[model samples]
Target: MSSHQPPRPVRFGILGCASIARKLARAMLLAPGAAVAAVGSRSEEKARLFAADNGLDVATTRLHGTYEAVLDDPDVDVVYLPLPTSLHVRWATAAAARGKHLLLEKPTALCAADLDAILAACDAAGVQFMDSTMWMHHPRTAKMRELVDDKDAIGDIKVINSVFCFRANEDFLQNDIRVKPDLDALGALGDVGWYCIRAILWAVDYELPKTVIALRDPVKNQSGVLLACGATLYWADGKTATFSCSFLTNLTMDITLVGTNGTLHVTDFVIPYEEKSAEFSVASKSNFAQLHIGWDPLPSKHVVTTDLPQEALMVQELARLVQNIRDAGGKPEGKWPAITRKTQVVLDAVKTSIDKGSEPVEIAN
Candidate 1:
């Protein structure tokens, strides 16, 4: 770990007392060097209730009404924005102007231009900016990357097929900003499809696709629900990847990679929140049965099950954030600018392709 001060565990000021913020607050409690110093909601009464429910010792951080007030608090060094996708840019820009380190939820903006502007503002202010693509920080993802790098068992990868779909309950629509039309197109892609894309790109060394073709069901107006969508991502080197995402079905997160010589299978691209172990398979295209060598990557096979930690991945991410801050003497270099920018650009391109009737769009890096 770097020897820098590490920013004193990043006093977190959460914007909006949403359920997800509660989870993040809980995770912050578990994450070393991090704490939910304060939480703000439109209603002070609600914010106080939330703080009390969480047993927060510092009640002063629990403010009511107006997100700007939370950002203005001197006690808050890092602001975790869990507001709706549409509100991301406005709040992120404001928080950046205040010189607070930012941890915004994914799809930083509805379009690439907005994302670029937000990043530019953050850059101008020299604030550390991070999108909460928490899965990228998961240890299992690194394990999967290791598996791919160790052998390239998937062999000259040709296709990347993935899906993240689940039928959310009817009650989930209440007051949820995710169902708005302008924001809906980014629904599944940002919410769940981004996970598939992240896994695929990371496995392939974050290569940019040459061209992308996408399609969405227009007849069904579920506002933000991406009932079904598909993308054909063409790599520069002739390799291609195809992905599909939906929100009209039961929860299914699966990723399968096929290559000329072998195949790699990720049974649960997104597993149970309590997942402790992941089951993966590899075999040559020519011979499938004989080479089935499956083993637990965790401490022990028995202990290696999908019973995940209540605060595992998010806490882990916060730990890394602290370390990253320390590494840069309180400001890291590079700082995932490409990932954050590219994520929005690609998502926008995918939406364009969908609107253009699945016509292919040239993807820029």
Candidate 2:
């Protein structure tokens, strides 16, 4: 008998027909070990339309009128939840309690306390939990991590800066769910700032900062939702990080890490500009040559190619974890939830600082 084991597919039930769910549905189709088994929405007709529009096979994919029906489906091994920020804790906890693994959207919950409740439910039910930070699964990110972690190549990291911003059109400003207080309470700070905060935390290996201070005079919408904001994070060792996010700027996503002996820069940090390949630049031990006319060493670009998009890779990884739990009786991985909690902690601190008149706030945990 051959020793090769065929891939085990993970059946995913989408909790809502959100726009982001469409991208993940396509990813599930692309992932070899994942399949979209069900789609659910407040409206049955809307769920059916979503399945048809997203090219999910009607024979294979179940359409449910209510989110509860999807959670109650016995065939679903995983639930991909892309609900609004305010709704994550309720739906995610319910899915986990039903023995379905969770692939939740980022800004996992409104705050750390709320996220902990969902995580606690998952832990009690013995189900895996993973936030949908697609870039974390990309090969390019792994390669970059290797370089940044290497002492000789990057030296001691001193500072990190991340920025993620995009101009919102009139429709988005007026009608987007993100700007609605009840929908996404933190607004731009929760939407794009989550990525920036995650990037900074990733650079520091998920270490919590000592203090967080929101920049003064954050731009707010008419409904008192943040439209543009920035924050500074300070570590005990003087390792500092800063991030800025906005809904009123030109499209830009960047991360710059400066070390004692080197520097790293990436233009497209959150989502790669190209789906097929990604690139980052690094420089080490460089100084101006002959009166600053030219440099003796120039930054080198590293390119990583991937056959499948980052989102598909994320699905495959989550599926693999689910398969391990199903076939091998493996304990759920704690790394994803741990990382998510850390990100949420920082996010909470920023929001608290902003609420307190942009005063400095110490991270409680």
In terms of lDDT, the best-performing candidate is: 2
Q: Candidate 2: misplaced stretches above 4 Å?
A: 1-5
lDDT of 1 by residue, 1-365 (tens): 45564545667888987677777777777676677777888887788887877767654555747787898888787788888888878999999898777888776788889888788887888777777776565566666566567554456777788877777666644334555556434766677777667666766777778788885453234453554576777888888777777656778877777777666676565653454555566655444234555422321111124233434465555546645664445564454767777767667777788879888999866
TM-score of each: 0.85, 0.98
All-Cα superposition RMSD per candidate: 4.3, 1.3
Candidate 2 lDDT, tens digit per residue, 1-365? Answer: 24487756899999999999999999999998898989999988999999999999987789999999999998899999999999998999999999999999988999999999999999999999999999999999999899999988889889999999999999999999899999898899989999999999999899899999998989999999999999999999999999999999998899999999889999998899999999999999888989999987998999999999999999999999999998778999999999999999999999999999889999855
Clashes of 1: 14
Q: Which ten residues in a row have the lowest lDDT in candidate 1?
A: 295-304
**What is the model-wide C-alpha lDDT for candidate 2?**
0.94
